[model samples]
Target: MNKVLKQAIRAILPTWRTTPVDVMHRESGIPPVAQLLEARRIRFSARIKSLDPAHPLRPVLLPRKYASEPLPPLQTAAKKEAAEEFNAWLESVSPLTVIVYSDGSLSEKGAAGYGFTVHQNGRSLRQGAGRLGPAEVFDAEARGALEGLKAALRLPQSASQKIVVCLDNIAAARCLRGQPSDSSQGVFLAFQAPAKRHRQTDIRWIPGHSNIAGNEQADVLAKVGCTHPEPMNAAPTLAFLRRGAKRQCKDVARAWWNETAPDKYRSLNLDFPNCCPPELDLPRPVLHHLLAARNHHGDFADYHERFGHDDAKLTCSCSWRKSPTHLFYCRKVDSRHRMRLAPSPAVAIDRAIGRDFEKFVKLAQSSSFFEKICPCL
Candidate 1:
């Protein structure tokens, strides 16, 4: 096509959604001229050569035609066809609609590249590309969807309208339906603002390549987004790294405190602050160990008097066994279990370590001094 023709097409296509194609074609009246040019080319006539003056007639812009006049209701095969056609034409003119489709590409690192494509309709409106970081395939899919949606919304569209994002990735679709992507913070926020104002505002997922125009375009767009530079952020990848670093720091702290802290540090003489009630006994091993450590230094007869007899045994008034199990398991005395009866040698150490780590976490979270001391984390 000539430059004039290309420019004209761009100008008129933006109105195709609301305008009837028959009306548009009649208004454009370019078919006869196009046919005439085709005839001239077929004949290889001398007149065709002569028509090319220093400047030929400026090309007439043609409005787009909807594939079907009466759109079928949405269901069944016919409705599907109509929906596909309607969406195709709408994409051509709506300008706000961006479709992205994605498939995974695998590598030896147990990694996958999300193959993607972006399109407005049959026309390739724009493209994007990206590479997955250390995330699962589903995570990659969600990231791609989020990226594509962001790209579309950032385009020059009417401000009143929210962009419709179509994707072929089922995992991505599920993720969007379930939870917003933490990585796509900007896009997630962008979508959230309109959600408060409108009930129908949302990104949509269509089946892949089911002859669906938007889905096909999305597939192309996703591929482009995959290869293109990631959307702007101060440290998009760094957020993940920071999160990982935080977890590693916590693990290291816990391990070190367990290995080095004394039994007293683990069983800090407190009454299980910030823990479940003592009545619940909710696996509060550290609290139990702490109680045991404090009580273990006292008289065994006192421990027995507090929690020695089972309720059932007491009710029956029977002589039960006098083993450590009788004091701990049978009597359900946590102090007895923590102080003496636990078979694992590591249990006491673990309790001691946990108590110290808990204190450290609290102090670190609250104290400016602690923050300065461990700036590496």
Candidate 2:
């Protein structure tokens, strides 16, 4: 067995970096690497003592008891036994009544999408999706959890019901389980909406791509929701569970702006939009002035909050706005109106545009509003 292990290690060396001694010990259980090499039992130049499990080189060296146990010497074999032991322990305690899997994703930076599937007795109970915009990854994960619970609520209730929510994301499960940070606003609010219903959920972590059935399905749905660029209904699936079905106080004006405004402002590509007005409508003349300040890099006689003009050559940074040039340079009445308006309106407009843009991006990323915005390039 030792000689066979040496040959296996040499053959495996082309693919892996493990030492022959390490391979032999991992393969042949009885004599161990050191004893086999000391007895001229294996082919290797290094001293037998160097191959000792007690040597400082190996971190995964098994204890004497580990070798004595009726187990294979390979670390993989040991881990399999440990996993079986753990599975036995869990089965003894709870018996795993249900497995729920959930996932969250974002198409753009601000949008969030999530999906979940619930299973028990080898059957699916429910699954769902939530779409919104301008939320972070943490927020998306929370949405997955909250939305997952909502899906589970569609099933029959029982006192012995034990649900295991397998999450593709660690942050989300950790956040919900109180292992790390708190859940995000979308998730927190989603959880609150359905809290009265799904009272028996247990959050759990599972390694992705390990053939977890429900987890893979949930992942596929999450990908679809995240990658799909079309606009959606923008309703959280858990909303029906909320008391009186009262919706969160969303700013409709912000939503409208995001739906209509160009991507340059909403996507944070430039600083000029952030400086736009928020509450009040901006006049046409001042809009041009701010656009000019942003694009042409010009100076003004007085730097109004919106307009930064460089009058020496009369250039500014308004790259998107349509200008006939005479609008700013003309000594006409309209150009005078452009210069005389209160700076407050322009300031308010710029700020509002910025805020609305951010909110739009966030909400659009949700599973509900998956719309793609083609900015005016």
Candidate 3:
């Protein structure tokens, strides 16, 4: 539409339910335009009110993030002597010490789940798992680490005993180290923050599936937690927030397209605005000019008259009014130049727009068709 004319219609209508009218009466500032716009707005508003209400778009929330250190490499092989020493260190830990192993699992449906096992002197002290709702693997991994660290920090261990939380996911371990990488920030906010206050707690990363009993137990619990039937805490991670935002935008856009697209535009009709349908993917200007010649804003006597080129007379070289009506009915141009239209001139113009749009799409299928006939492509 012409910007000024659209604004005039908007000014009269309450903006919620205004529909496009036959804008051949293009006097945007005139009283007739306001009257026409009000009538159309009322009709469109009633129609929309009668239809089912559009589904609501949901909003997403996200956790706060802090500037943390860069991440470390996730997994490294343990050499023969080092592996033995690491196993020995685990074996020789004080009986009063608290140690935890955590893991995360992502379901086929992308549900986030976390699990942890707390042990004292190589015996199970407590074990639990929880779901993080819809989330990515890394975010779930971080959540598991936070939960394990949280558990380890609060345990009834001796004051002299060391507190250690281990996890196979290197990314989550880095988050525990206070590095905020993409979506793991939520874990820090919801669980890791409290654990951070207790400085005695230490986080360790070990190679996954290294025959470590605690780590294997955590891995199983993580998988089980993901498909748990009960509702779990759905803390908004950065990844979940991003997904929600993208979905909301797409839904709103689709709804708007459905609501405002021209009623005459059928399933296959492309939107050909201003003589060029970018969606048509055409390669030449011939069809563009050809299509525009049938509209009110065309390079015809009616369009020229409206812009004060003549004395508002729309009569053409064929001695007929060269308005949109004449384009469909005019015999002087070509006997075969026919356009699909209704009996009413206004409706004919509206309906023809969709019909021509579809025609243009079909014409555009052959990329080199225009290039063969017309040198300028």
Best by TM-score: 3
**CA lDDT, every model vs. true structure:** 0.41, 0.45, 0.57
The digit string of per-residue lDDT tens for model 1 on 1-377 reads: 44465446335433323333322222232222343355344444322322324446532222432423553222233546645754664646555444444443334543434544555544555555566654445555665665655555555652455445555555456445444444443444454554434433345555555766545544554454355444444332323444444445344434433454444434442222222223223223333323333324212333445556333122111134332122222233223233342456345334432443343223223332212321211
Positional deviation of residue 349's Cα in model 1 after best superposition, in angstroms: 55
Which has the better TM-score: candidate 2, or candidate 3?
A: 3
For model 2 the local lDDT of residue 13 reads: 26
Per-residue lDDT of model 2, residues 51-106, tens digit only: 43566564333222221335221123343454454345345644337667787776
Question: Candidate 1 lDDT (Cα, whole model)?
Answer: 0.41
TM-score of candidate 1 to 2 decimals? 0.31
lDDT of 3 by residue, 38-64 (tens): 545555543333332353233233355
TM-score per candidate, in order?
0.31, 0.35, 0.43
Q: Where in model 3 is the C-alpha error above 4 Å?
A: 1-85, 158-160, 190-192, 230-236, 241-377
Supply candidate 2's per-residue lDDT for 377.
19
How far does residue 57 in candidate 3 sit from its true spot (Å)? 21
Clashes of each: 24, 41, 0
